[model samples]
Target: MNEFTLTADFGMTASDNGFIQYGIHPGDTIMFKKAEDFPVNGSIVAVIIDDGPITLKRISFYGDSLDCYLEGGSSRVAPIFISHAEYGRLKVLGVAVSVIHSLAPAEE
Candidate 1:
């Protein structure tokens, strides 16, 4: 797939155990595409949960059910399993094709 980039326009800060953590600083570029538009194994994606907010995770399948496995980056633990009924409630926002972190210099 061709590579592309997106700039992050917002930032979020959360705390755990009285320690503050930051994620996705504004102006950071991220490369991504629609997950449903390109369903591939081992792809990281943003998915809608219960018609609620969007979340990011790796995609997997459990029998006829769709599953999402959370990688240990933050304090969040455990894998999430959703039945076809529950899966229907989820909307695949986008697949993370690549990441252009703030630490990295911009490419020409």
Candidate 2:
């Protein structure tokens, strides 16, 4: 079985970066399983860009690249496109399995 970690900080990290949509709040707890393979299309992933802090994004594979979106589903947020060459610096920490939303209302 893949190991997973529950962290409220992970939610807060994403929230702090304006990933407050998709029901993931600053104080919410999240369960993330360690990535074993490249995620298929439309997987919610935790990625670290060029040694930067981790961020949660929905990734969709393109021909030789990928697009990362802050919010998934009906939201209209623009995606951040990553080219093939940049893949070397991108680290996929894991895939998100579920979220436990915070009781407190989110701050706008």
Tell me, by TM-score, which candidate is best: 2
Error of 2 at 76 (Å): 9.1
Candidate 1 lands at a TM-score of 0.55
TM-score of each: 0.55, 0.64
**What are the runs in model 1 whose C-alpha is more than 4 Å off?**
1-28, 63-75, 104-108
Q: Model 2, 52: alpha-carbon shift in Å?
A: 0.9
In model 2, what are the clashing residue pairs, if there are any? none
Q: Write the per-residue lDDT of candidate 1 for residues 18-64, one digit (tens) a residue.
A: 11122333334445665446356566566676788655556666554
Residue 107 in model 1: lDDT: 40
The local lDDT score (0 to 100) that residue 74 gets in candidate 2 is 34
